[model samples]
Target: MIKRLINLPEKSSFFLFGARQTGKSTLVRENLKNGWYVDLLHSEEYHLYLKAPEQFRRNSVYKIEKEGVTEIVIDEIQRVPALLNEIHSLIADYPGTRFIMTGSSARKLCRGGVNLLGGRAVERRLHPLTYLEQKENFNLETALRFGTLVGCAGKSEIETQETLAAYADTYLREEIQSEGIARNLAGFSRFLDIAAARNGEIVNQTGIGRECGLSCNSVKSYYSILEDTLIGIRIDPYIKSVGKRVSAHPKYYLFDTGIANALQKQLTAGLDPVRRGRLFEQFIVLETYRMISYRRSEAELFYWRTRSGSEVDLLIVKHGTIQAAIEIKSGTSVAQPDCRGLRDFGQNNPDVPLFLVGAIGQPFFLGNVQVLPWERYLENLEQWL
Candidate 1:
């Protein structure tokens, strides 16, 4: 398993929520070393919760307290929602007792909210493998080529891509449909395909809903379902400077590039080099964003598009300051015209770093902003911050 860099506070209890296979369980077990674990995923106690919740509660409290263990991990806590309230009460009364609740969905958890905002459980999101974490396993070239969010690499790119594509389908089957989030399972499956196809692009939910014959509200709710399931990510528009002509819509990104490719059902460029490169660019920006978010860094990922025509692929803001502006070109050839967003953003915030993040020869001066290749883009992220 790839070692997750996002560290949990050793002194305080927090909720670690993420999609299955993102290594939440592995991270906690490996890091905590001594927490008493109740794997709700494999427990008969989970079925008991569905039937007789009180019995499940009785066993948990007795199991933890009787063992004299203060730290506890309840895996797949959403599976046993009623246990949350009692768990909260356990932490509150014991004070010394700490609990870590992990789950993939919030819908069932919300419905089972015996307590809201989890007064005691601090909720934090665990995203898919980031560029930084995967560096130790896959080389920088492989990661950049595949982008982020693929699983099981074989000896060859063909074999690796095949494995990842299969994983994507299995992920949808296991996480989305089987999780029982959307009542219309078939519709949600189609929606996944559409969302994956449109990943890294501005989403028009109302239009998508109309096209899919789902209500706008249903589409919005379904988007939340994806968020809860940890399949999709949305970057809100950066509207801090309203005087500039800015686009009003947010952009959507899938958590994994393999999933995005699987949804589109195409592994390689085959012959269309241009299309493959664009997809590669999208993958890089999204994974870079995930790396920042997973670390609990204070940055919002956004895209800037002017009213007339100019556009920037990524605009990262840190605590109200425009920290970085980036444009993505998949190939080596880049011109001054391509640096429009960086120049424009620099005109407003002169200190913020700017870059064309793709296969652009080297990191050099493009009017004060840096220009670097995609292979080295992630490494430069820390420097920007």
Candidate 2:
């Protein structure tokens, strides 16, 4: 089993949220041993909880008092939000018990204004596998092509492609349609393709709405659905004025590259140099995002873009300070021109460390900006913060 980086609280209740197939269930099963498991995906358990949320409290109390159960895991807790009320009371009543709540979508819980245990539980997120977790088995090409989802690991090329396609469908059917997050499936599906195609580009809701035949408001709602369901993330443009006219729009990225390809209907196609470059940038951005999350750091990610088209791929920020300014390149070797954005960024924020990460085989430098292989940057990612 691959070891995930997320460490659950030893004795406190917490919510584990992640996109499907990211291995939340497996991680919980492996690390959280001897716990009372409740699978809400099971039809019977779902119906029982749906009919009588109070019964969950009664049963949990019995297990805690009679069967000496200290840990109770409720998988896919969003399926029955009512149970949260019961869990809330149980938590107050039994301080010794730990409730592990896992869910793939936070849309229902947040939108319904459901009881969130009154801040009784902390929140943790699980992301698609990172290169650090894969280690020796990590393949840059495969990750850029098939992504780092847990189910894609160790699978053949064809199997991985199939898994990604199915994953896309599963999100559409189970998460979007079933949850009623999108009232018009056809329009939302079109938006998804357009969104996937523009994965790392600055988001223009109006432009996307025109392309997908959706209203601008509808497009924004669709993006919100993706974020709430853990299907994608938005990296806002860095607002700090570094002597340039900064763009205000944010960029949206799917949780996994393979899923992005699948949504764009390019899963089986060969990745050309241009396509590979975009995916490579996406891969690096995602890796950095995942590492920051796993470390539970205060760092926030943003992209820097000027009106003249100069752009820095990522900026790591913490507590109103710029931690690192990163420029991603897909080429094997970096040239001075490739570090243009970093140089421009450094004109004002020279104190902030600058990095140019790409497919290079060795670490080198172009003046003050450090150029590193993607792997090396990820391995020592924590130091930058």
Candidate 3:
């Protein structure tokens, strides 16, 4: 398996969040050498923590102070979120110990539950392997088709597809039911399949409701559950006073294309690279989003579009100012249409960085935007740090 970057925080209290089987436990275990693990999924541990949160904290503290105990790994921490408040107090009392907390779901965590970091603990999201992770041996051409989860380029297309499908059934399906995201497995599963097939499109709740045989409100609520559960997300259009013509509909995207393909019933492939360019861009958008949040950067991801034809795929606004305008493309053809909207945005709003992220090799300056591949852009993430 590919390893997480070596630079993430190991000494501080960490709450690792991700979809099930995305390697939350694996990453934490591999990095931790001295932590005592508390598997709350175990019935005894769950009852113990739920019954006496104080005692749970004592167990955690005892582990921390033991001769060999250097840290504490609370697996499935969300199972008993009440322990977070106790953990918070323990951190105050025992500042010497480190913590490596892992959870498969974030539904409660994001709402600022009691024991969570609440601005104190650093939050890290462990997503499935990215393009970079499996790039060493994977085939770039086929991997590009599904975007990269593990750079499984050397693996046959069938094997890679099966892995993704298994992840959907084993991790996503299990997590959803076990965590009570939806009581109806059949309807929810149908939603997943439909959303994946419709990935990379602007969808209103009403349309999805009609397709899924659910009410509009039900569709909206389901989408929220997905966003919170870390399965899929919808990015709203950047609304500004640009006045003349900007589309207001938000674009929806599956969290990972590999996951998207597994949920989809059919593959939509065209020989023309530009034909599927938008989907490629959407893949980059999701990666950029996860990478930003993984780094704990305080940025919100959105896209910009006009009522007519002017558009930009991704926009980053921070601290009340539009900091960066990003446009995504399939290849590196250094042309006007690819760079026009980004350059125009930068020209209209000076001081903001304009960027064009694509799959094409090499990097160059095109007007106000720096045109570069997804990998090249990631190398400079520290600059944001």
Which of the numbered candidates is closest to the native, going by highest TM-score? Answer: 2
lDDT of 1 by residue, 1-385 (tens): 5667676777667788876656678777876655678788885757767677666557667766787777788888887777776777677777786788887666677654456435666777776667577666756445534444423443478876776666667767545666667778767777777777777777888888877778878878888877766767777666766553243566777776666776677666451566556566667766666667666787777777677666778887777777778888776677788888778767877877788876666667777867887758787676555
- How well does candidate 1 match the true structure in TM-score terms? 0.86
Q: Native-vs-model 1 lDDT?
A: 0.70
Worst 10 residues of 2 by lDDT: 240-249
Prediction RMSDs, each to the true structure = 3.3, 2.1, 4.1
RMSD of 2: 2.1
Off by over 4 Å in 1: 110-118, 140-167, 173-175, 241-247, 268-272, 344-351, 383-385
TM-score of each: 0.86, 0.96, 0.81
Give the range where candidate 3 is weakest over 10 consecutive residues by summed lDDT.
240-249
Model 2 clashing-pair count: 0
Error of 1 at 149 (Å): 4.6
On the 0 to 100 scale, the lDDT of residue 355 in model 2 is: 93
Name the candidate, 1 or 3, with the larger TM-score value: 1
Candidate 2: lDDT of 242? Answer: 38
| Tens digits of lDDT, candidate 2, 246-296 | 335789998899998888878888889899999999999898888888888
Q: Which pairs of residues collide in model 3?
A: 84-115, 85-115, 129-149, 134-150, 134-151, 138-153, 138-154, 139-153, 139-154
In model 3, which runs have C-alpha deviations exceeding 4 angstroms?
A: 1-3, 41-58, 65-68, 111-114, 117-120, 131-139, 145-159, 241-248, 266-276, 331-355, 361-375, 380-385
- The superposed Cα distance between candidate 1 and the true structure at residue 112, in angstroms, equals 5.9
